[model samples]
Target: MDRLILADTERREIKALLNVSMDIDLNETKDFELSVHRSAWDDTYQYGGYIFKPGTEIGGRIGRLNTDTALETVKVCGLTWRGMLNRKVIEPPAGQDYRRISGELHEVMKELIEPEFEGLFLVSEADTGVTVKNHKFERYTDLLSGIIKMLKSVKYKLRITYQEESQRAGYVLVEAVPIIDYSSQIELSSDSGLDFQLNDIRNGYNHMIVAGKGELAERNVFHLYAWPDGSIRKTPYYTGIDERVYVYENTSTETEEVEEKAREEFAELMNRQEFTMNTSDLQMEVGIGDILGGRDYLTGVYMAKPVENIIYTTDAYGTMNVEYQLEGED
Candidate 1:
């Protein structure tokens, strides 16, 4: 029954699970921090699950026993990987250790994140022509936590993709925008649905203003897309002229890139209306970054993109819940 495992190494299984839960997000950690629950009885001699002591080299597996294979592993400090919430000990640096780098997209990723990830591959969609300045992470911060925070602080439009390492590589990809390629559109109605509601359409917006310090101070853009064919609504209906301001600091984003991202912000803003639907309709194949289009008895017709898609499973069956936001059009 060993459907879940926390391993001492990628090849060897260590702790067979009692229960496990994980959350994957588009704008969140690619190397997810999984929350696992081990039954108190599992460690007893009669029960038979291995004990995971702190500081052991830890890897994991989650699949049907003897049927599905384990997932690719990442090297993690076992002590920090322990328990419901893995909080690392914050300490100061022993020496003046210096690490610095500058280059194209891949090289920059290699210098900043590859060491922590090991053998992982990063795919960047932007032109490598743009350069990154040398950055030295401050001392006393946990390396992984520091870099991830740095990624956010520096303000790069990045989303991590978790994939098993194949041929000396793992996946860490960056894109110009969130990937929303729906193979096909799906429809849901009051009776034909799991859950549906319109939330804060008044917060919907058609404009974005991006500002930063230094040379490129501000860039503003508007969101306008062609009304769907044979549609009655000509424009977005909001309480007022909803507009938003986004800022990136300590960043070297070029003027052109700033303008481009500002526009993307405008499009994702189309996601003000919320939609919740049964993943069973899509055979549980629907995932984040997918586009969903449907009509509501009260709200009418609309198109949306999946921002948060959650799945729950036990030994036999699984259910998926997807939360969708409006998809901004051209």
Candidate 2:
């Protein structure tokens, strides 16, 4: 008979089959709206590098390994936005006029929810406010909230781009991978009345044990729960531990004292052998009967796998491709 052995090659093949692949595109649009706006915002919030002015002088060496020389510095202009709204019709008394203007500005601000409006504001000339004419401003708070909820429910490889066509018109492209949510459940218990608990632990757990009929050989069993989002909650259950016996043969031990000494020695040898056998026989089996057969004397083990690589590439036109691979096991 051939002995069974777990091969590294087999394990590697199983791991490859279980791995996940993800692709994300950072930019996939003609209009680079989001990119431009993000860049502008970043540049304003974080200081951009200083510029040098023509004909200005500074005391320093500008060339490589040269003596001190004169240099010039120039400051970049800050970009900002301010808005003014004129009320076309306001039937109000003296103090109420301020409230009316506030109302009008609030309505005008609602138009900013449009992508074109945001893009225009990001790229428009400083201090130039784009005005809406003959347009009734409708609130988009619900729409915005719904969009955010939808985005969070799925996994996505996101791509963003920005484009500006004048001071008042532009668009952004947002391409994303479809999102998916999956879940699984597992239960752990034992027949020998041993208690178990798997609650409050965000990571899943695994259980291993040894069981079978007979004194010389026993079968190993294993159970695993691999859930990404939440931990498994389990109540304590009873599974009894099994004890084994070993018999030892002794020669030239006819005396009572010799027999007693031999019995003690034999017991120690049996204990060591059982420990070795249990360690070597650990196995993970999945089936209704297997799970029920060895519920007691089980030990829990938890393991995690991580993503290994993520790569992104872009061409001359700024189109991007992204690839990601997660390391895993079978």
Candidate 3:
């Protein structure tokens, strides 16, 4: 079995953990769980101690530990949760036509690293060459939500990594990478040694009434409509046609800003397709944020969706398995 190392915050090594499994989602935080015999419990595995592999930066800190006397085992959970940022706020000046890792975005990252994030996070200088339009962070907005919204505006996802043997060792590197479309290169089918199942459930409101920050009479409000063709617009194309209305509340006071945020959220909820694929028999590495092309012969359906979530697990017998959950429309 592969070893999972427990390191201190200063990048010092501790002991290797036993029976560990890790899960990483492209759009969310990473999580891990490990268990050992009751006699093997160590006091050094305290909360906030980093849990990672020796060569790579893919890991989190210990969040919780439980001792089970009935089973004589000690279980630990490593949660790479960013919920702490929910209490923090960031306000960057609104700008337009900003390139990735430059100008206003660079200032935003610096602020996030210093007084905002308290120097706990560092961002990479890798430029994805994706330009953003009307990039704005509402005043007093939570840092976590603002970062997610900003990345989504440019079709990028956030990845936190660490440098093991560089000048920046022990420092976390936050990167904004574009969602790569690999549909033209890798095609998965029944003939390609991949077992898959698709579930397309269509039941959701297509219309949204966004209420922005204000009192009863002065409340800033806007309307957003989601088309079946995966486009969001302020103007509705048809009247009372599949028009199930849903109310969305926003913290922005500007009507236009509220409409933009509402449209983004509404589109995320409505423009998704779910599929489960087993990659045990495949010979390639399928990463998160990668758009994979899949075709099912029985249903005659084709999908070019992104890998939103993935789980890597190693059993006690030294066998490793990878499972992927692909989502989003073609």
Residue runs of model 1 more than 4 Å from their true location after superposition: 19-185, 199-257, 268-274, 278-283, 311-330
Model 2 lDDT tens row, 1-330:
011111121111111101111112211110111111222222221122111111111001011111122422111221111110010222234553211112222233333323333332222122212222343212222322222223233332222233323443223323232322111222233342423322223211222121222333332221222123322112212223432223333334333334334433533332111110111122232210011111223344322222222233333234434333222211
Instruction: For candidate 3, write residues 1-330 as lDDT tens digits.
Output: 356667776656676665544443323445666666667666887777776654343566677787767986677776553434455677544683222233444445555654654445667765565655555666657776677668766677655555454454355566776667777887789998887776664666677888888889798777787777778887785356656788899874455566656777887666456666665565766556667777798888776777765666665444557666666422
Error of 2 at 278 (Å): 38
Candidate rank order under lDDT: 3, 1, 2
Question: Cα RMSD to native, each candidate?
Answer: 12.3, 29.0, 5.2
lDDT of each: 0.37, 0.23, 0.63
lDDT of 2 at 61: 9
- Give me the runs in candidate 3 sitting further than 4 Å from their true place: 1-3, 18-29, 54-57, 81-107, 114-120, 126-134, 138-145, 166-169, 197-228, 239-258, 261-283, 316-318, 328-330
Q: Pick the candidate with the highest TM-score.
A: 3
Provide backbone clash counts, one per model: 2, 27, 0
Model 1 agreement with the true structure over 145-179: per-residue lDDT tens digits: 54443444343333433343335322334332333
TM per prediction? 0.40, 0.20, 0.72
> What clash count does candidate 2 reach?
27
| Higher-TM-score candidate of 1 and 2 | 1
